[model samples]
Target: MKRVWIAVALLLAVLAGTLSHSFYLNSFTQELTGLLEAAEAKAEQNEWASAEELTQLAHHKWDEKTAYLHILLRHSETDEVYTSFREVAEFIQCQEGGEYSAANARLIAELELLAEAEQLNLKNIL
Candidate 1:
């Protein structure tokens, strides 16, 4: 009975950790996605200054999250996002519509994937 109770406690702790990671990843990505969409929309409307501001705001948020996220998530995934932000900022500076749009699209997709990987699902559990 004591052994069974210990096993349950361990399982619960793992489940809690998985759920926490998933929630954090999903919430951060959604916020970043909003920033990206706003920036992209500004770019589409030819508001370059507004687009740049939004991109910088998004980058600032990413930097803030990185401090804590590095402890919870894979470094590689964080690095991918960090790289994407730089590319987006560069494209915004050059006012390259196609490239900026493409980079944001890929960034959003990758963020979603990162969150999904952390969710407490059967595949992740197995």
Candidate 2:
């Protein structure tokens, strides 16, 4: 009975950690997506400077979460996001609206997918 109780406690701990991580990842991705969207909007208006600033801010925020993300996420997934960020930054620097929008959209989609993948749902369990 004591061993069963110990096992139950450990299982509960793992569940709690998984749920917490899911919540954090969702929120973080949403925040980054919002920033990128705003930057994309600015670029649409030909506000290159503001767009660049917002992109940098979003990149900085992502970098700040690097260690935590690396721990809980596959490195390949995180690396894709990193590459997307670089592509967006380069496009913004060049003031190429079409390319910037495409890159920004890709980054946002990647973030959304990342969040979705981490969600604790029945589909994921199987």
Candidate 3:
């Protein structure tokens, strides 16, 4: 009876941990989606500085999402989207010799689309 109780306790602990991790991943993915949308909207309005800041924020959120994906799903479609957005964000950050407004705007739009698609995929999974 003591052995059976110990096994049951361990199973419950594992289940709880899995549920908590899923909740965290869902929250992080939603945040990334919002940041990407905001960045794109700011860029569309020609708010270059604000767009740049939001892009950085989105990139950070994507990084967190990617980390969670690595641990939970291990190279899912979201991981590919995260990698693409990370590359785009880095490219935008590196463009120092040109007028960044147009290029940044385009990148933001791309990031927004990618985030939306990823969010949809997450919705199906969840």
Candidate 4:
């Protein structure tokens, strides 16, 4: 009986960890997507200054979240996103609409892929 109880407790702890990780990943991706979208919108409007400001904000947020993410995510993917963030800022400064939009799209796709991988789904668990 004691052994069975210990097993159950361990199982519960694992489940809790998985769920918490999933929740954290989802929340982070949502916030980031919103930031990227705002930057893209500003670019669409030809508001280069506003777009640059929002892209900088996104970079700041990414830096703040990097420590936690580095533990949970693939280094290459995270690094790719970091690079994209920098490119987006540069494109915004140049007011290159096409390149700026493309960079934002790449960032959003990377964030989505990262979040999905972290989700507590059968595919990920298996």
Best by lDDT: 2
With a 3 Å backbone cut-off (N, CA, C), the pairs that clash in candidate 2 are none
Q: What is the TM-score of each candidate against the true structure?
A: 0.89, 0.98, 0.61, 0.92
lDDT values, one for every candidate:
0.87, 0.95, 0.60, 0.87
Give one digit per residue, the lDDT tens place, for model 2 in 53-123: 99999999999999999998999999999999999999988988898898899999999999999999998
Q: After superposition, how far is residue 28 of candidate 1 from its true place, in Å?
A: 1.4
Pairs of residues clashing in candidate 4: none
State the local distance difference test value for candidate 1. 0.87
TM-score of 1: 0.89
**TM-score of model 3 (CA atoms):** 0.61
Least accurate stretch of 10 residues (summed lDDT) in model 2?
Answer: 93-102
Pick the TM-score winner: 2
- Residues 1-126 of candidate 3 have per-residue lDDT tens digits of 999999999999987886676566556656765776676566667665776687688777666556555655636555556555655466456543243444444544554444444343456467
Error of model 2, residue 85, in angstroms = 0.3
Report the number of backbone clashes for model 2. 0
Candidate 2: deviation at residue 5, Å?
1.0
| TM-score, cand. 4 | 0.92
- Order by lDDT, highest first: 2, 1, 4, 3
